[model samples]
Target: MNELLLDLNEQQRAAVEYIDGPMVVFAGAGTGKTRVITYRIVYLLNLGVDPYNILAVTFTNKAAQEMKDRLVKLFPHKAENVWVTTFHSLCAKILYTEAKNFGLERNFVIYDENDSIKLIKECMKEVSVEPLNFSAYDIYELICRAKDNLIDPESYKINTMVSHQYYREIVAEIYSKYQKKLLENNALDFGDLIMKTVEFFKNEQFADIKNKYAQRFKYIHVDEYQDVNYSQVVLLKILSSVHHNVCVVGDDDQTIYSWRGSNMNYLLNFKKEFSTKDIEVKEFKITQNYRSKKTILDISNILISHNKHRVKKVLFSNIEGEFKNDVKIKQCEDEYDEAEFVAKEILKLQQIEKFYNSTVAVLYRTNAQSRVFEEVFSEYKIPYKIVGSVAFYDRKEIKDIIAYLRVVVNPQDTVSLKRIINVPPRGIGETTILYLETLAKENKTSLWEQIVKIDDTELSLKVKNSVWKFLSLYDLLKKYKDTMYPSEFIKFLIEKTNYIKMIEENNN
Candidate 1:
């Protein structure tokens, strides 16, 4: 216990040792927020608290893994007992475990952003709406707002101005149909994880589910509390209503996810809301800065002071290193000039002080700005990485495999069917797909359904044979879908279909 407190400042120590009803620690940047949270978990464990009863939530998988890693260093055997995970992942676990209550199957698939968009497009097609009149992205944002606010499809109300009533009606129709499609497919988009979990807890019929979760989690910790949306907030409330031993660490000034329904009011009004419940809510401000120099902290403090709504706290740093002028402001004529100036500075740093190219960074407001910098860096032969962009999972090969799996799981998913139908140079072509689509629409069935009944159609012998072959492959996939693991299914799909060989042949 002493070792845990050795490196913590006084305020951090108080935050870790506070064993009470409710607490909020306003952890500023570079103020040892992660350290305080880990130590607090250790402190709770040291008090003979059951590790399984403790839940620590973070906004990202990386943060959760870091906390789990730190705990493993202290108690390797008990690290797995505590639940440390991102909000969406935890909600997914809850939804999967409690699938019976929600009528979801045990092996429901989780769709990502692309899958959601495709589903929306299909919804629009079903409604006979054009993408020009209503974009998929705009409808997606509308649905996202509704989900974040825990609004049901029947209760989805459009608050648009009178001038846009027609558009609003279109969006509402698409949203309703989109939800029905998801249910038919036995799939849940990322937002549904939180939204459905909140629904389960709020429904009186599932009061037992709420009580079970609330009883299981005696102590709850939320990192990045400012970034939680309405559904996440409700879920947290249900889980902590029993014990009320909830500790949240966040800085109101750092709430930057407002675009995605991150309500800053949740953090700002936490104390006021809890105090009304006759609960003792203690507040701690860990303002000691141990990461940056005093100069940087001074500038940051001045910048953040402009925010009107926040808890005022003093930030101090005792770092030794100092620069003559740490903050630099430059005005460039245009983006190209800005890129050239950055490249020149990088060269100068390497020439004068031997700073490595990897050590320097050029921050930009938009991902498109990286193009100009990449051109300039290439002109000067400076290697750089465009960070924060799609690094994985968006690759063509990965998407192909994921589409295959989606089709395997949900045969009615016309979007995934279209994406992989002609992929890997299958004999199926656009003309054949168009014919199949016409038949399906006339029969009021899915494209896959029409393909299975290809013999009843007037399709040419070649098209009919190709459709039969495709159907045979999917038949084999369906046969093994339940028996084999996803990994084994992927391997079987790749090997049996010669997808890897096709890629190699194309490359050579």
Candidate 2:
């Protein structure tokens, strides 16, 4: 037996060694699923499979990176060849290489949620649909859901039904105009990355392109498979159509992303989708609860068994201990009472069990649920830090800095330019910016270009001076773009833009 197989349990070992056909691992919570996945890749490599021919996809960047890091430690020489990335990242790579087939440039901008909302709002305004009546956010979400289901604008208009015909008509128009704007700006929203890749594969003109990738990746591994949406399902199916050597690891009970279009039906129906005449899909279950005690596992199993759609599997504790008192259930009158209970429980555990405050943690379903917990904890003076609060990249300061860099690289990125143009109290009021946007639209030019030719536009002396100062700063950054390293350029931008001073004043 290999060193990799030594550490795995019976089911984990079986899963790692099974490379004959399509397989689905019904991995229970905390059953070393990630470990099984990493070892399975190693197992294939030991059989003389080329690392370049394998693809391992997961949902989050953090998980993908962790897998890559583990592989690097095990196979430092061959790890670089493996395709370990998120679904969106894999699609982005494919799209970047074959963008021309879809009439998109390789350097097309990828719009974030904020940019998408801004574009949707613009489209709504153009179609004379007021934002107050129909929120831009809601419309953007509808568009995203449509894209996730692989429905194009024309298909959406034809198939969609709403109570009010006028509202449906307005949304359809906005969807059409929004897609047109995305193309005109050479941009793709987050949903488009997966939707476009699926589109490219299904297009008959790109058969060779699809076949190239299908033939390239012989073994495909998808983690958290239950959270896959329709577009992603189509993508995996197309990629594995040739070889049929796909392995997915997930539990139907763990499907929590339905609002984001994730369908557990895909995982539940894996065998039906992948089985063929020559090869049969194999199902494996790893039900050992490595992270919990027997009492807790018993309670969890009993509670989750009520879910009608999940696969029936019993989780047994791998650990041997007398943990009869481990399971506890408490009922509270309201959120405030629940929060108080949690805070008091934490304090009691720290004092009675001699546990460190740093070792204790709390988990919540949504961001809004954290407010009560925070209030209770603060009142108790409990030393704590929130995990997964607002992400670093989502911070206003971070976004403002990134916008500056984006405008420097792509002057036509009006979304990013719009974000930073009036930032730092530039005195570039909304009315002035709106005027420039109107002029740019009429002239068929970008906002950056309009700003560059601002001297020719009709504007007040005060507004013109502020605008010129901003342009001068932008031009200086553009001049040093190639000369300075990224770090130095960022420092120079902070100093030149007086960004730190603005942040200080705002904080005050």
- Write down the TM-score of every candidate: 0.92, 0.93
- Tens-place lDDT per residue, model 1, 1-508, is 7887886889999999997788888988889888887889888898889998999999988899989999889767776689999989999999989998777787677878888898899889989998887889878888888788877665664553213777777777888898887876677888899988887788999899889989999999999888988888888888989889889988877878988889888887778755545787889899988898888888889988898888898688998556778878899999899999989988878787657777887887778778999999999999998767555788889988888888887777666788898888778899888898899878888788888898998878987888788888888988988898778888999987789999999999
Candidate 2 ranges with C-alpha deviation above 4 Å: 160-165, 321-323, 343-347, 350-355, 377-384
lDDT of 2 by residue, 10-121 (tens): 9999999999889999999899888888889988888889998999999999999999999888777787689999999999999998888767887787888988998998
Candidate lDDT (C-alpha), each: 0.84, 0.88
Q: Each prediction's Cα RMSD?
A: 2.5, 2.3
Cα deviation of 258 in candidate 2 (Å)?
A: 0.3
Q: Candidate 2 has which clashing residue pairs, if any?
A: none
Could you say which candidate leads in TM-score? Answer: 2
lDDT of 2 at 268: 94
